[model samples]
Target: MGWRIRNGMSISIWNDCWLLGFPVRKVTSSQSTQVDLVSDLIDMDERSWNIDLINPIFNEADIESILDIHMSNSNQNDILCWKGEGSGLYTNLLTKRVSISNFCPRCNQSIEDNTHVGRDCPYARKVWRLLDIRWSDDASNLCFKEWLLRLFMTHNKGKHICIAVTIWSLWFARNRIICEHQYPLFVAIVQKCRMYLRHFSIRTHVLAWWKPPLEPTTKLNFDVCFSYAHQKSCSGFIIRDSAGFVLGSGFIHTHHITYVFMAEALVILQGVHFAKDIGITRSTLESDSKKIT
Candidate 1:
C-alpha cells in the first residue's frame, strides 16, 4: 500500500511510497528528514511544489518524481492507494489468486488448508502472538471463515478491523514465502501492520464533538501554513471562552520561516504573547501539532 498525496498530511516523507520509480518506492537521496510529513515539502496555499526546498534536499530523479505528483486544489487529506494506480479500484489492483503447494510453505509440516496456513502454522501463530492486542490463539478447531465470524460476534468493531488487518498481513507473508522463496521475520510483518494501523488511527479516532474550556478559562488554538519554496508562513490563533464566543484572534504572513516545526512553535509563542496582550490571564493552549503542544 502507498499514498496518493492530496494535502500530504498523512504521507511520511522518508519512508512512504509517494515517490514512484525508486527501488524501495521512497526518496533515495535522503535517508532521514527533519520534517515528519510530505505536506511540509508542499506549498499548501499556492497548491504547488516547493521548488527551492526540493532542489536542495532530493536527488534529480526523486525531485522530478515529486514534482510530477499533481496537487489538488481541494482541501481533502492525503489518500491511501494500492501501488498508486490510476484506476483507483481495489478489486482490480488485488493480486490474482494462484494455486500453491498443498503443504505449508513456511513450515511445510502441516497441510496448507486456509485454516491451517492462516492460524495453525507456526509463523502465523507467532505473528498473531507478537501483536499488541490480546488474541485468542487457540482457534484451532474453527475454519478460517468461521473463526472470523466468531471473532466478529465476540469483539468490538475496532477489534474486527485489527483482526482483518492481521489476517491480510499473514496472507502477505505466506504469499512471499510461496512465490519469492522468502520467509519474512514474524516481527517485521507485525511492524508493518502496526505502521499501517497508525496511519488510519489519527483519522479514525476524531472527536465527534468539541469540549469547551471550563468556566472563565479561555482556549487559544494556534495554527500555521508554511511554504518552503517561498520561505514564508501564515500563522494565526483564535481565543474562545467556554460559550464558544471568539474573544481575540490574529494572523501573520511572514518570510524567512524554513521548517514546519519552527512555524508551529512561532505561532504558539506568538499566541501566548497575543493572549497576554489581550489580558487573558488563565488560558489553555491548543494546537494540532503533537511536537508543539
Candidate 2:
C-alpha cells in the first residue's frame, strides 16, 4: 500500500508508506527518536521539502523518491490505498471482476495467476531467458511470491533489481499485447528493464567528487563545450597532481565542426598533446561524455 499525503499531520514518518515503493518504518524507531510524524519532513511555511532535514536521514534514492512524490492539493485527509493494480485502487470486488479470465493471455495455456504470469507463462519465460536469468524446472512448483522471496534471499541488490524489474516488464508487456494489441520484442523488454535498473543504481550510488591519481602520476580531466551560435567548439582540460594540485590547464578553440563526436575526438587528441608537451609520461584521462569515454 501507498499513501497520498494531504494534511501530512496524521501520517507517521516512521510508520507510514508515504514514499512510493517503500514500506512503513523504513528506518527503525531506535535510530531517530525525534522524528515522528510526516509533517516533520515538510516545511509548513515554504510548502516544500525540508532537504536539510531529510538529506542526512535518507539515502539518495529515498530522497529523490520523496521529492518526486506529488502531494495532494485537495486539503483532504490523507489516503492509504493499495497501489498494486496500477490504478491506486485494489479491492476484492475489482479482483473478482478482473480474475474472470482464467487462461493465460500470452501463451493461451494454463490458468492465469501470479505464478503463471510471472514464471509459467511461455512469453515471460522467454524474456527471462533473453535476460540470461536462470530458472530451474524444479522451482516451477513454487508460487510466484515464494519464488520471488527465494530470489531476494539468494541474490545481491543488483540481481534483485533485475529480477523484480524484469517481472514487472513482462507483466506490462502482456497487458500491452492484450489491451492495445501491441507486440513488443523480448529483447526490448530486457533492455527496458536493464535501463531502469541502471538509472536506479545511478540515482542511489554515491561517488566522490574527484580522486587524485597515485604518486608521480597526473590526472587529466577533459571536456568539450560546443557553441551553436558560433558553429564551433572549445576543448578544455585540466591537469592535476596526486594531491589534486593544479599542474596545468588549457583550452583550444577548434574550427567549425559538423559532428559532436568529431569535436570530442579532436579535444581528446589535443588533451593528449597538451599532456605530452608538459613532460607528463604517466597520466590518466577522464571525460564526462559517455561516447568520448
Candidate 3:
C-alpha cells in the first residue's frame, strides 16, 4: 500500500506507509525526534519535495519514490491506496478471466503477459526509446510489476503519468491492430499520451488572470472553437488596448481542420494577419491553450 499525499499534513515520515517498497520506514537517523509529518520534507512555497533536506536521510530509490508520489493541487486530505494495482482502481473480480495463453498479438512473440506488453516487447521498447527514457537493455529478467515500479519510482510525477499513459496507449494500439486491423503509428501514440498528460496537469493547476498590456501597446487575444460532429472550426480574436477596452474584434469560420492543434495554429496565423490588416503594429498575442501559446 502507498499513500497519495494531498495536503501532506498528517502522514509521518517514519511510521506511515507512504514510500514504495515493503515495510515503509525512513532511514535510521541519530536525530530521529526531529522528523514528523511528510510536509516537513516538502517546500511549501514551491509545492515540491525538498531534495536537499531529504537526500541525506533516504536512499536514491526511496527518495525517487517519495518524489514520484503525486501531490494534489486541491486542498484534499491524504488517502491510502494499493500500489500494486496501477492507479489503485483494481478489484479481485476484475481478475477472474485469467487467460493462460502466452502469445503477443502485436509481435507474434511466444511469451505474452503484462511484462512483455508493457516493457519487454519490441514495440513497447520503441515507444520508450522515442520518449528518451533510460531503459536498461538487460531488464528482461524483471517481472512486469517490478519493472513498472522501478521505472515510475525513478521519475517525477509528470513523467510517471506520461509513462503510464504511454503504456496504456501502446496496449490500445495493439488491440486496434489485432481487432480493428488498423495500424497505429508510434509517434501518434506518444503524442496522444503527452497531450493527455498536458491536459491533466492543466486541469490540476489554476489559470492565471489575463493582464492588459502596458503603455501604448495593444493585446490581441485569440481563441478557436471546434465542432467535431460538423468537422469545422471557428476562430475569434479581440484586440484590446492598454486600458482593457476592445479596439476591434473579428471572427472566421473554416472547414477541413484535422485536429485541435491544427485549428489553434490556423487561428493564431489568421489573428496575426488580422492584426496586420487593421494596422495594429504594437500588439501582443495571447491564448489560453498552452499548445497555442
Candidate 4:
C-alpha cells in the first residue's frame, strides 16, 4: 500500500510508501531523525518538495524517488491506496487462480489484463461503442483502474453508473464464455442492460442507493463480498419497494467459496428462495453476476 500524496501532512516521511514502489516503501538508510511527517519535507507555500531537507537524510535513490512524487497544489487530504493498480473494481480472473495464457478468451488478441477485459479488447470496445457512452481516445491505453478513474472524473453520476455497469457486464460476459462455454451475441447483452439502465434512478439523501422496482413489485439485489484473509465471505440480499423502502434484507456467512463468481451465484440462488419464503412472487432478482436472468 502507498499514499497518494496531496497535502502530505498525514503521511510519514520514513513510513508511508508515498514514493509508490513495491517490497519496501520506507527509506532504506537507517539514518532517522525528528522528521515524522512528510509535511516537514514539503514547501507548503510553493507546493513542492523541500530539497535541502530531503537530500540530507535519504540516499540518492530515495531522494530521486521522493522528488519524483507529485504534490498536488490543492489541499486535499493524503489518500492511502493500493499501489499495484489504479482501479480495484475490475477483477483479473487469472490473478485469483492458477497461471495460464494471458490472452483474452473473447478476442484471442492482446494479453487479458484487467484493462483489456474491462475496456480495451475488441469485444469490450464494441460494447462501449454500442452503449453510446463517449470515452477519451486514449481510453484503450490505460490500465483498468486508470480508465475507471478517468470515467468517474469526467462523467456525471448517471453516465458513470452506466459505465460501471457496462464494465461489470463485460466481466460477466467473459466468465460465461469461459465457464459455461456459451456464446451469445453482444447486442443481446447490450439490449438486456439497456432495459435495466432505463429504470435506474438515484434517490436523494438515501444511504442505501438502488433503483426502486415498479409498484407492487420488489427488487432483490444479491451480492457477496470476498475476504481471502479470513477464508470466508459474506453474502447478502436486500428487497426494496417501488418507493425504495426496505421490504426485507438478509445476510449470511459463506465459506469454502473458491471463486467469488460462484459465491455470487449461490447468493442469488439462496436469495430467490429467501424471497419466496416470504411469499413474494412478483419480484425482480438483481445481481452483479449475469449468471442468472
In terms of lDDT, the best-performing candidate is 1
Cα-lDDT of candidate 2 = 0.68
Candidate 4 residue pairs in backbone clash? 87-145
Residue 58 deviation, candidate 1, in Å? 38
Tell me each candidate's TM-score: 0.37, 0.39, 0.37, 0.42
Identify the runs in model 4 with alpha carbons over 4 angstroms from their true place.
Answer: 1-97, 202-293
lDDT of 4 by residue, 184-285 (tens): 678977876787577565323332546778898889888777777766667777776777766556665666777766777777776666566446688888
Per-candidate Cα lDDT values, in order, are: 0.69, 0.68, 0.68, 0.69
In model 3, state the lDDT of residue 119: 77
Measured on C-alpha atoms, candidate 4 has an lDDT of: 0.69
lDDT of 2 by residue, 1-293 (tens): 33546557767776554565312324333446666777788777666778898888877777777788665433333444322332221223324664345676667878767777777777788878877777567667776667877767767766876897887787778656654456898779988988997887885643226888999898988888787777788887877888777766666666677778888887887777666655677899987777875
What's the true lDDT of residue 10 in model 3?
Answer: 59
Q: Model 3, stretches more than 4 Å misplaced?
A: 1-101, 206-293
Find the number of clashing residue pairs for candidate 1. 0
lDDT of 3 by residue, 3-58 (tens): 55656775777655566433334434443555578888877777778888888877
| lDDT over C-alpha atoms for residue 34 of model 4 | 54
